[model samples]
Target: MRVLVQRVTSARVTVAGEVVGEITPATQGLLALVGVTHDDDPAKAQRLAEKLWQLRILDGEKSASDIGAPILVVSQFTLYGNTTKGRRPTWNAAAPGAVAEPLVDAFADALRALGAHVQTGAFGADMAVALVNDGPVTVQLEL
Candidate 1:
């Protein structure tokens, strides 16, 4: 599993001109672009969610949990895209939808279990994501 974590001031995901998920945090928050691979399971999702909530990237090096920050989780199989061979990218490292969707849900659920406010985009929708990245801080984690 992998996640692209971005600290943001506000963010939202829209589908077909309709807002699907949104968050305008009172304090700094995170946007987690989660991807799943063939070997990933629910356990990995849980661990990563906990790690994301505790990650110290917000103001004063505080964690999302520390500041009661919300997290917007989006399914992003492209995180595993590979382009080492040719101009076109390959999806060989990404898990098939059947294997990925549930894990994405598990990731959000884990965040909720950790007392983090979790918002999310539709699993397989064509979404327009908007965000104001705070400090322009972004981090990537793979596990």
Candidate 2:
């Protein structure tokens, strides 16, 4: 499992020009881009979701769990891209939707269980995401 966490004041996901999910926190929060690989299991996804919820990347270095901050979750299979030996990026490491969608939902479900308000983009849909990045802070984690 891999997650790219970005601190954001607000974030939204749209599908077909219609807003699907959104989170505009009173205090800064996170925009999590999740990717699932073949090796990732439900437990791993849940753990990473917990980690992101408690991660202290907000102003004054507070965790979202501490501040009741909201989170926007989106599926991004491209995080496993491999471009080491070619001009084009290969998606071989990324898990197929059949394996990935459930993990992505598990990640979001875990966050919600942790008491964080979680918003999610439609899986397998063409989405346009918008966000106001707070502090321009972004972190990547692999578990």
Candidate 3:
């Protein structure tokens, strides 16, 4: 499991010109782009979700666990994209939708279990995401 965590002042997702999810301007919060690989396990997805919830990237060095900040989770299989071969990126490392959708949902559920206010983009849908990246702080997480 992998997650690209970005600290954002605010974030929103739109699908077909309709807003699907959003986060208010919080003092500290995360925009998490989550990905699942073919070998990824449900337990790893759960652990990664929990880790993101508690990740310390906020101002004052407070973790998300300390602040109860909201999270915007998006399914981003592209995190696993491989460009080593040629001009085209190969997505063979990414799990197929049938296997990935459930893990993505499970990851979100795990975040919810941590008491986070989690917003999500539709799986397999074309989405436009907007955000005011706070501190331009971004981290790539794997579990």
Candidate 4:
């Protein structure tokens, strides 16, 4: 499991021109782009969720769990795109939707279970994500 975490003031996801999920926090929030691979499991997803919640990348080095921050979760299979071979990228490293979708849901659920307000983009949909990045802070986590 991997997550690209970005601190944001606000974030939203649109699918087919319809808003699917959004988060506008009073202070700061997170836009989590989650990805899964063949070896990833629910345990790894949960662990990554915990790590994201406690990660101290926000203002004043506060964590999302510390500030009661909201999080926007989006499925991002492309994170595993392999471009090492040639001009063309390969998706072989990314888990197929059948295996990934449930794990993505588990990650979000884990965050929610940790008491963070969470929003999610529709899995397997073509989505447009918009966000105002706070401090331009971004972090990448893998488990």
Candidate 5:
């Protein structure tokens, strides 16, 4: 599993012109783009969630857990895309939806279990994501 995390002042996801999830501008939050690959399981998802909750990339080096920051989780299989061979990217490293969707849900659920408010984008849907990245901070985690 891989997660591309960005510290955002605000973020939202819209599908078909309807907002499905959002983190209001009143607060600083993290936007997590999660991806799944072969050999990934629920345990990995849980561990990643735990790590994200405690990660200190927020203001004054405070973690999300310390400030009770909200998190927006979105499925992003493209994280595993490979382009080492040719001009075109390959999706061979990404897991299929049947295998990835539930794990994405597991990741969000784990964060919620850890007392973090979590919002999620629709899995396997045509969507648009918008965010104002705080400090332009971005981190990639994999397990």
Candidate 6:
């Protein structure tokens, strides 16, 4: 599993002109673009979720786990795209939807279980994400 974590003031996802999920501006919050791979297991998803919760990237050097900040989790298989070979990105590293969707859901559920206010985009839907990136801080998480 891989997650692209971004610090955001606020974030939202829209699908077919309809808002699907959002996070209100908190003192600190994370926008997670989550991806699942064929080798990823539930344990890995759980571990990554725990890591995100405790990741110390907030202001005052606080962690999201400390401040009870919200998290917006979006399924983003594109994170595994490989474009090194040619113009078109190859998605061989990404798991197929049948295998990936459940892992994505489990990842979000695990984060929520860790006491985060978790918001999520609809799985497998075309989405438009809008965000006010805080500090322009971003990190790639893998497990």
As a whole number from 0 to 100, the lDDT of residue 132 in candidate 2 is 91
Error of 5 at 100 (Å): 0.1
Best prediction by TM-score: 5
Global CA lDDT of candidate 4, please?
0.94
Candidate 5: the clashing residue pairs are none
lDDT of 5 at 117: 98
**Against the hidden reference, what TM-scores do the models get?**
0.97, 0.97, 0.96, 0.97, 0.99, 0.97
Model 5 weakest 10-residue run by lDDT:
19-28
Error of 1 at 16 (Å): 0.5
In model 2, the clashing pairs are none
Q: How high is the CA lDDT of each candidate model?
A: 0.93, 0.92, 0.90, 0.94, 0.98, 0.92
Q: Encode model 3's per-residue lDDT on 20-116: one tens digit a residue.
A: 9898884668999988888888899889987887788898888788998889999999999999988999999999999999999999899999898
Give the per-residue Cα lDDT of candidate 1 at 138.
Answer: 93
Q: lDDT for model 6, on a 0 to 1 scale?
A: 0.92
Q: What order do you get sorting by lDDT, best first?
A: 5, 4, 1, 6, 2, 3
Off by over 4 Å in 3: none
Model 5 agreement with the true structure over 67-110: per-residue lDDT tens digits: 99999999999999999998999999999999999999999999
Screening candidate 4 with a backbone cut-off below 3 angstroms (N, C-alpha, C), the clashing residue pairs are: none
The regions of model 5 sitting more than 4 angstroms off are: none
Which lDDT tens digits does candidate 2 get at residues 1-143?
Answer: 89999999889999999999998656687899999999999899889988998898888889999999889999999999999996999999999999999999999999999999998999999999999998899999887
Prediction 6 TM-score vs. true: 0.97
Residue range with the least summed lDDT across 10 consecutive positions in model 2: 21-30
Q: What is the lDDT of residue 139 in candidate 5?
A: 99
lDDT score at residue 59, model 3, on the 0-100 scale: 88
Error of 5 at 74 (Å): 0.4
